[model samples]
Target: MTGFVELARAAQAARQARPQVPLALATLVQVDGSSYRQPGARMLVDAEGRVLAGAISGGCLEGDVAARAAEVCASGRAARLMYDLRADLETIWGFGAKCDGIAHLLLEPLTDWRWMAQAEAVRGRRLGGAVVTLLDSHGGGATCALLDGDPSPAKWHVLHDDARLLSLPELLPLAHSTMRTGHALLHTVADEMTVFIEPLVPAIALHCVGASRGAEAIARIAHTMGWQVTILDHRPALLDELDLPEGVMRRRVRQLEAVHSALAELPHDARSAVVLLSHIFDVDSAWMTATLPLPLGYVGVLGSRKRAGQLVEHAEGVLAARGTPLTARLRHKLYAPIGLDLGGESPASIALAAIAEIEAVMHARPAGFLRERQSPIHSRTPSPRVLERDQAPTLPEVPLRCELPEHPAE
Candidate 1:
């Protein structure tokens, strides 16, 4: 969703800016065993077979996808492309590459309105579910149904004719599960009917308090990764002189004494995060004093362990006076000395390490060296390879349409 968001916007702009041109879309719905990209990654192609946005593989499969997209564009029909990147000495696709995966991709002519709606929904932070679903029409039973709005188990805004998919008792549970756990699944409703579920929960929000060198780095990296970014400072003079990046929202607040006041300004909920980088213990405590009581994805202070403890003690005093003792869960979630140990004294390096920690905490993943993990570098599932052969199981017949992940393409 992150990769597709920017690309979709670019493609839409290009198409509207130059209506004479035609464009196409490609999305990797499933990847088996050691794929360069994961499921839900997307790309955009033009009539001339140009790469507009996103890349499925590092460089192994874009050319093929682009070529196929061109053919699909000419024919005005969607296509399912297969790329077996298994390292075989016989095939050029595996040439000198540590490839051993099969990629299932959907190629279709670009739809501008749909792409814009999708990107905007993702960027707008109005949605909740992270899993992205691609309803495949490859199984012959094709339908026009596609859900693109803020999806909840209770309701789904189907974009096309009545898919009636929500009526399935079995599917509702699966949908609920996917919402809880951001997992990708390809389910076969019938012979030739499949649905790829790849929940792309919108990027998490990161609020950087008190702009500084480290704050700048955090904002930049967080923005590039498609995280909703807000840089807040009570002091206008200091924040005014700071050269923040273009996308990072710079906000001026009178004070951080009341969380509601700040939240009212932003109107963010638990999915949002707040990091204290003021380097001033009193300021950080004020932010944490208000932030700790609420449910946020992450709350951290950019300082040493001792500083964190000091702020914690101070925040506790403030909270205790207000008749609310900070709970154990909140304490556990707070990182006093925020960020992983990347061992760099520079502001950028520290910022990188810190944001990494924040993100890990947000996703509830352990922060550790990737090499240290026994599983694959990108472990959505331990056995994605097995998915290729024993694909979706047979189910009752139902009309389907391969709903690829949308881009703004906001």
Candidate 2:
């Protein structure tokens, strides 16, 4: 979800900078085996075959995908490109991609920028939604639509060139299920049409309740991970002195009494995370007490076990006096001693551990080695049913050396 947001922002910036440059979008709709990126990953390609942002593969597949995208931009037609890298990749395809996988991508020209506009509308809205694309079985046509709002027929809106796919009643349930589960899915109706539903969720919001050295480190690390980061401190001087990444937000929180109001201005959804690392006991305590009742996903306090216990005990007393006891639900959300058990005393190492822990908690995963796991590394959604070979027609073959005409100026 966060990756899609970054791609959306990049595509938007590129369009704004050069509106006359024709562009195409390639979406990885399916992958069957070991791969660098999973389904729903995207890359934007211009007429000159430059990758603006995002990536569908590590580095081996972008060149070919960009070449195909140029043809899409010239013809204004959607095409499906399949790469079978399961065996003897160097001998068969000469690409030397050691990854034993099969990848399917959908490339379409950006004839109208309505899809981009809809994506920008919900980029940071804190609302979960889905993008549904209907594709031809023969790879001749494609239409894209956006689904946002409650699970009601009247509220679900579809935008695209084709109105026939938009009126399909069966797509609503599939799109709703994908959004609810936060998973991407590919579904085929008989052998005529295939639907790809990609979930869109807001990026993780990290509240660094400090402007200390540790806070700066955490902000930089989280920003690299595509998380929304904000550094809050009681002293404006400390905040000014702190160096942060380009997109990191900073707030001067003046008084401990105004902690609630300060937090009110930030995100309060279940995707939100907070770390009380101010090092000032009174300020951390105040923020901790205020955040207990909110809908935050993770809350961490940076200190030793003894200090963490003391801080929580004080918060428990304060909440108890207000006739609201600290329940197990609230206690489970607090991570004292704030990080995974990665052994390091430096601020940078500590920041890495803390970010790792928060990511695990937010995704409901156990922080353990992948080699020890029994299941696949990536989560599995419902698999696409196999279409009959006779019924599934192949896409038109475009020569590798086909010359694409330059995009004419508007």
Candidate 3:
């Protein structure tokens, strides 16, 4: 979502700088089997044929899309370009496409204020919304509308391409569905309008439940990736000592029970994760007991397989003592010994492995090597939790700052 917003901002700026030069946005709206880029991926092009912001494919389709975008800018109309790489062994556009897939791109000249409005929507809006582009308009001539789903009508001021409002109350119902499915749908509304509704949700949140060394790595990397990270710990001393990157929220709690209310109050969805990195049995046990009931996207504990089983037993014991029954859902959602087998003993490698697990879960992807997976290298449907254009927040990547402590000298 942020990436699209950035493109919007860039588009607006480019338009402002040259006022006369036209710019167009080509969005990869739909994809068939074996696409390098999935639906919701975007690429921006200008009248001068320069690619900006996003890419629709791995250097295979951008040239053609950019040419189409140049045509859209020159013609001042919206257009859709369909590419079928699997059609034949050789053809124009470089003697057969490499992806062996099909993609539908909605290319529209960004001449109106709607792009700027989307940029603003990405700025502060959090409730999640969608932009319903009337692709049938065939480019600049068609209408684009934005309906922010988070707030009521007061905050969600609709904008149309022609500077006049169109009564699209029917879109309100679709907004709910878009947010739920986290995918843009090409729907035929009243008056035979074909609008692509793309949902915009909040960034993924990772609530780290300890200030251990592993916790620092998680916070730093997740923060760099634009995830909303909240470092929660009972020990103020340890929490303060953690050198997390900017945008990481630090919460100081006084007891194990404090986490319950904290977790309850957090704004989370299926993309959120709660990772236990306290490294202490009592602390981890208390957190697991408290977290197992919450409907988080992931509940991970850092430990060995045997330790993971033991922790589950401890959590069940703790919950049973309180007469709380652990649900099967907890078993399904929890990733004990959190993270993938990246096989690095260093702190940074461990952190990478842990985040990789969360990423896989968020995308409903199995954690395995690409060579081992027979399916396409890129998954077509991202995690339903991810909104259109919602990449990491706009922040510089954080450098690896963690220095693992040396083992005791012989």
Candidate 4:
């Protein structure tokens, strides 16, 4: 989400500036092995070989991709650039990086700005969506980005429409699967043309229920990571006194009665997380009880193990009285002694540990050292290889139109 945001902001600025230098969009369509970035990663480059925004690799492939972008802009045609990173690390062409993989990128001229508008529109909705890109053949480099409830009847907004690509009945199913599973898929249509289906989910939102120094620390770190941060407190003075970044939001609510309404107005999706740092027993208790029934992914309380247990017990009694049961699923969402066991007593160290834990839990990963893990650092599910038509299961049909727009000959 952060990568895409950077790319979008840069591209939008470039468009508004109306630069004389032509621009190109580099989409990392596929990866054959372990790499710093996965498929669906993108970078925007200019005719002068400057990287405007985003990154395809950890500085290894950007230089080469930027050079290719110059050619793509000049020719006015999309070019498929492939890099074999499995060579010697010390070689001059290797960029001294140890990325032993194959990266395939689709470099296209950024003549059509409608795709940019569509991307911004979908993002503004704060919902999940899938982007389908035609990678080589059948209007290669055409992209269709639509949100969950787009009003436009046409499913795709691209350079031009291609009849052959539209005839492929399996395209829509593959895209639906990508959105449902929240995983990117590199697919081959009829064993000839290639397409990439990538999912776009909203950024993680961190809700700080207190305006203390600890909350300020967490908000600073979260803002740097591009997560939405909101600081809330019953006392408006504390919120005003706390120094926070520009985009961070501040809200003041009256005690228990307003807690429910305040939380209801904020993000309540699985991507949202709430942390109780008020240090006030009654305040934390009221917030905990209010958040239990919501669909938030993580709910952390800053206190000792004993205090956490006591809050849960109190929440249970309150919920039982209101005829709402504290189910196991809801209990699993609570992290009583908030944050990871990073061995820290200071507010700064404690904030670091909490943010790290939230990231791990949100991704459903075990918070442990990379050296101790045996499996790949990133999950390589749905194989990067060309998915066979019969091999990939057909997900249920959806309203999405996966038509590939034809890239008109220059």
What C-alpha lDDT do the candidate models reach, one value each? 0.68, 0.78, 0.70, 0.77
Q: Estimate each model's TM-score.
A: 0.83, 0.85, 0.78, 0.87
* lDDT digits (tens) for residues 1-410 of candidate 1: 36655675678677777676678777788787878788777787887878877888888788777877667777766777777776542364535566788887877776453534554564465554433344545521112333344343333444433254423333444554554465666666543457665554556788888878788888888887788888888888877777766777888877655545876666356567888998876778888888887777788788888878888998898899999998898787788788888899898898898788878877678988777989777777521233232333444544333345443323
How many residue pairs collide in each prediction? 19, 0, 7, 1
Q: Which tens-of-lDDT digit does each residue in 1-410 have in candidate 3?
A: 34565676676677777777788877777677787776667777887777866788877777767766667777777787777868632554547655567777788777653444453445334667666566554333243555544423333443444312233244454555666777677666444555566777567789888888889998888977778889988889998898878778889878876767787777556767889888888888888888777767889999888988999998988888888878787788899998898889888999999998998898788888789988768654442343444332333333112221232221
* Ranking of all predicted structures according to TM-score, beginning with the best and ending with the worst: 4, 2, 1, 3
- Per-residue accuracy of model 2 over 207-228 as CA lDDT, tens digit each: 9998999999999999998899
Give per-residue lDDT, candidate 1, residue 381. Answer: 54
Which ten residues in a row are the worst by lDDT in model 4?
144-153
lDDT per residue, candidate 4, 1-410, as tens digits? 36656776777677677568888888888888888898888888888888989888888778778887777788888888777777634463734566678888888888654555456456546665666677656345555444333222245443334323533246545655666566788877653766677777667889999899999999999999988899999999999999899899999987778998998789888889999999888999999999988999999999999999999999999999999889999999999899999998999999999999999999999999999999988767873433353233444434334443543332
The superposed Cα distance between candidate 1 and the true structure at residue 21, in angstroms, equals 4.0
Off by over 4 Å in 2: 1-21, 91-96, 140-143, 151-158, 383-410
Which prediction has the highest lDDT against the true structure? 2
Question: Which regions in candidate 4 have their CA more than 4 angstroms from the true location?
Answer: 16-18, 88-96, 138-140, 144-164, 167-169, 383-410
Candidate 1 wrongly placed segments (more than 4 Å): 17-20, 88-94, 129-171, 267-270, 381-410
